[model samples]
Target: MVDYGQAVDRQADEINPATVDQRARRLLRADEPAAANAPDTHLLQALSLVLTEGASDLHISGGAPPSIRVDGALRPIAGWDRWSPEKVADALGSILTPAQRVEFDKELELDFAYTINGTRFRVNFYQQRNTVGGAFRLIPNEIKSLPELGIPASVARFAHLPRGLVLVTGPTGSGKSTTLAALVDLVNRTRADHIVTVEDPIEFIHDAKKSMISQREVGQDTHSFASALKHVLRQDPDVILIGELRDLETISVALTAAETGHLVFSTLHTQDTAQTIDRIIDVFPPHQQAQVRAQLAATLRGVLCQTLVRKIGGGRVVATEILVTTAAIANLVREGKTHQIASALQSGRTQGMHTMDQHLAELVDAGLITRQAAEEKAMDVEVLKQLVRRIDPTDTSVGDLSNGEIDFNDSFSPGRR
Candidate 1:
């Protein structure tokens, strides 16, 4: 049996002063009270550490030093004492409003955004093991373009469509929100239309540029997604951005909006293109599914499914699968033959459609990420291997797709090709 506690200790030791950036080291060396006694101060310091270390999230819990997630791995911040449950609650609660506190007390969980020192974070406070814990996800100050984010340039075409539903799907923390923001920014810059976005806690802040933007948050600006979307059309919106298609009512209203000739953009916590189609249809009742499918086929423009994989040296890169709803794909959705969608993606490359494995294979061939990392994110490992082999027949790293094993020793390295 393995001793996981010791393993964690070893990992923690790896994050020493020498390994951290200069800013992080300076913050660590600052004179501050113990975390147990000064929870609020420690919380701010931890948030600052997140920025300095180039981490995506900061995690706070009892019996653990505040940790930040970098490149999909968690590392404890050096020089911080382990927090107690009361301290954890106090630190996180200090930032909440009185009304928010009441809501949190009642629901035992809360989701909100916080900004400190000009940096914004999407925060969540929840109960775990009968104690309060918090997660702070750093929101980038600037919204990156699709190409900068490694999204295919073809996806930008959806931004120009006069009407139809464009869904961005991925698991949690897969940069779905970021992609949606980029598309919205694209519209804001190039088009002279009214863009209305309904978000829960509103992650990105978009100012009016060439277009008019009306952003509504769930709790503050509106009651719920269904409620805000209920009257959005009356507001004269040419482009609608729904943060996530969370329920049947929201999904129904969004579909209606798209069908009514409004360009709609939203997100779903589904893994891939096929699964995204299935999830939308599955949300309605059995009797309503067929009609929903028909509506989806008529209004759905495209789906971009994305996931982040660890880069070769450090940081992360996005691997995406886009489905550009060709007539055949629309027919598949209408007929409920969602399984055939993947096949459609395989042949629809000319139409800007590609599978997740294909993009992962491309990333490996470009030496942006290792073969192992691509394999981990691949929907079908065998298919990914075959795609990689096809991309570079001389790539001795990828063994025969028929075999179960790969030659990792010969796999991709930076500039190896």
Candidate 2:
């Protein structure tokens, strides 16, 4: 049997380039009798590649060479052959515990955390086309601060609030979990209170600093999110972090938790602030919608909607739409006038509230990302163009507002393009 411990301990930089392909071919040989019983050497090498290349995720599936998502794009590793169905299953299955194997066989899917050489990953194994596939998301060992993550300074205020609901909403793989971890870290460093988090397979492990932290994994610590949340209030928590407000029951309980004077942090799969608010309200039955809206207006502190955009040189950066609830915005929520929320965000920049397009323009102006990339991610292209023009009145490449003509070929020169 291969010594998995020694293999995992080897530094990624130590891998000899000349023998990498030979090692990969030998490890992937179909005749290996113990392939199903031990974690494949090739799988460990691919994970090491993820670390060395600064990739966010590793994808293993049948009929494809292992691929890593760097920045925001997927690039298949060179010098590796396409994996067969058996090869994919053997590599991924070797990592699952016997109990997890039973569960996966019963449910056809599984989600859990795995740690190797002190680096943790959030892993999901699923069946597709009668074959197994896996996705491994690398969780950084060190949690970053909000400023370090390029988040706006005003977002730190959410951590200071004694009570209310703050949400970080975005699509999958949009760094929602990382941002939430930063906020929780901030609270842990600055406050003296009890913080309880309910996560499905717990991503970031928190060490209690000034705050006492109790992190519960859904399947391991409790039956489900609803069950954990049902009893969390009785645990005397001052701050609650629901990993993702994924269901109606979870959302309802989170609202109650926030309403009853506990600061709540959660994530939603929504594009922007308006949609996030609407998603919560719409989750309830018609009879409960009005009450939920009122409850949301009263307890909602802020919503931060963010997306990852490819940066100018390499890597990726975040573009965000932040909504800091005010009397006017609260009234709009209560009155069901969410469509008008965008205007409020546009006018509320002094309060640190800005629409997504506005921030996209700022990122383009700062030369952190290109104008074309910003336009692609913008909610309204015309609005983005107008904001870019407003930032630099002398730039004609953004197109004359009088006639809608844009020059996409104009290389983004930061100061005056």
Candidate 3:
């Protein structure tokens, strides 16, 4: 087999020759301005610096000069001329090998991870109307803490349990993987058991501490998720982490992994708690719906419906609707009464459970986040208004709080979004 590390190093070497200063717009003084403008490997070197400086994402396109997103804002990198379509194509073509480009062409796009300056980037390179363009999201070297992320104490409770399934739900770029990494890190530090993670081009890197970790990346360490799931059972794993439950086969395998003495962690693209469950069950054929519901009812440990709400501190806070499957919740799920799970969560807070609205109300009360953000992300508005009501009964009137706005209420609605 060829060495990818060496191939990546070649790119690194190519980048170093240009000495693109990521912190500044200036290219190395030694390189000719005309050649640098033409497109070269040094762009990756410059990207390496931008990433090291904590830029959230980077974009290269046909009409625009290369741009980088730092702290959620777009800032133009100085010293670069307006890049034409040819320049954009040259920059992308220089890095993508002939084979990679062929594959990318066939797919109309490609998703892969590339490393430079020891920083890993989740890259999506593709064509746009016959023009080349790409975007890269920086993945940090260290896993951030849940508490550091201002994740509720209850969300952390998902990691403390030893078995069953925990699902993290959020929209794209909503910190789903980072949240999962925090939870996984929690287990890695506190538990003494075998943990296995199956991912496509694995994101977070975990160092073995109290727990042993086996990370399998698709197309590299394993051929597919189904095949890995087929063999992980004999590996004596105490926990199994699936990157995303994309297909029915993997979903079935994950539930089986949980049912047979293992704690399972996975993420899904869903807005709220109820929708998340619906999407999961919908993945299966109608013929097997009843059985899958029964299986989920018996083995679901929790479902953390979360979103990265803009916080008053200028970053973000995680307001999560956590569903810890209690006897009532399990019964509701088993009997095809998933809607009742929200009420169960609201009343079960003493047991470390909370609906999203409840959590949102708590954040607003604590002055951590605004109330407006809650209503906009809310799946059920009447319920959020009700929760605010309980916070202030005399102030029965409510206003929109979806855009970082807050207002108190007295009538607490049983809304689980």
Candidate 4:
């Protein structure tokens, strides 16, 4: 049989000449049998590659070579053996605890946190085509501030609210967690309060500053988010960070927490501000919708929806739709006229509230991101085109960005084009 390692080495030599010495050194590290049986070796090497390449996510599947997402695209790691099902299982099994292993075996899917060489990773293990596979995203230890992330400065206000529900909504991988963490960290630094975070698998580790912090992982530290929320009020928490408001029970409790005078932060999988409001209200049964709306309108502090777009040169830029609840917005919510929320957002820019399209237009005019990329990420392409045209009415080239071929479902991180 041909040696998979040697074949990878040959491929690497063909593709990247500069890495020949590095490839030779890696090949000399271990014998074939030891390397093949110990999947940990392969996993560790792949993770190390993630660090060196400054990649955001690592992908491992049975039929293909392990790949890493560099910038916003997938680049396969060369000089690595193709993963086999048995090999993948062995590697994953070596890392998962007995309970996690049992859970994976029973459910065929799992999400957990793993640390290697001081770097933390958020891992999702799953079954694909009847075989085990996993995806890993590296979580940076330090949480970036809002300005550092290039988000609007108005977001800091949500952090300072004494009591209310702040929802950071976005598609997966849109930096929602990062933004939420930044907000929580802001509050942590600025206030002397007790903060409790209940996460599925705690991503960023927050050290106690002036504020006391207690982080609980869903499955491991507590039974679930609902369970933790049920008892959190008794813990004397001045601030609560819920990783995600994924269900009605969790959302209900979050609203209760907000109503009871503790600052609460959470996230939802939604695209824009109005849709985020509609989603939370629609989560309840028909009979509860009105009451839910009332509760939300009263307790909702703000909704910040974010999506990452390709910047002009390289890296990603965040286009955010901000909804800072005022009496006008609250009345709109209470009156059940959420359809008009978009109009409110457009006019409320002076109040630090703006739609995603408006933010995209600003980014385009500032030359921070390409008009094409902004159009592709906009909630309303035609609206965005009009916004751009207004900025440069004489420039007829604005319409070129409306190709209608862009897939909005894809999530991206800060990376090269």
Which regions in candidate 2 have their CA more than 4 angstroms from the true location?
Answer: 1-36, 390-417
Give me the runs in candidate 3 sitting further than 4 Å from their true place: 1-42, 45-54, 70-82, 97-99, 389-417
- List CA RMSD, all candidates: 7.7, 7.9, 9.4, 7.1
Tens-place lDDT per residue, model 2, 119-148, is 677899999999999999887766767776
Best by lDDT: 2
Clashing pairs in 2: none
| Model 1: per-residue Cα lDDT over 116-210, one tens digit each | 64567898999999999999988776776776565787799999999999999888888888888889999999999999999878988999999
Q: Residue 272 of candidate 2: its Cα lDDT?
A: 91
Tens-digit lDDT track for model 4 on 1-417?
Answer: 111111121222244434533543453343212222333656766765665565678998887888887556687886676888888878766667777878888999898887754567899999999999989987876677777666677889998999999999998788888888889899989999999999989988899887999999988899878889899999999999999998999999999999999999999999998888889998899999999999999999999999888765555677889999999999999889999999999898788888899878877766666788988898889998888633553333322112111222112444333
How high is the CA lDDT of each candidate model? 0.78, 0.80, 0.69, 0.78
In candidate 2 the C-alpha lDDT for residue 95 amounts to: 75
Error of 4 at 200 (Å): 0.8
What local lDDT does model 1 show for residue 90? 86
Per-residue lDDT for 4 in model 3?
Answer: 13
Q: Work out the TM-score per prediction.
A: 0.86, 0.87, 0.79, 0.86
At residue 38, give the lDDT of candidate 4.
32
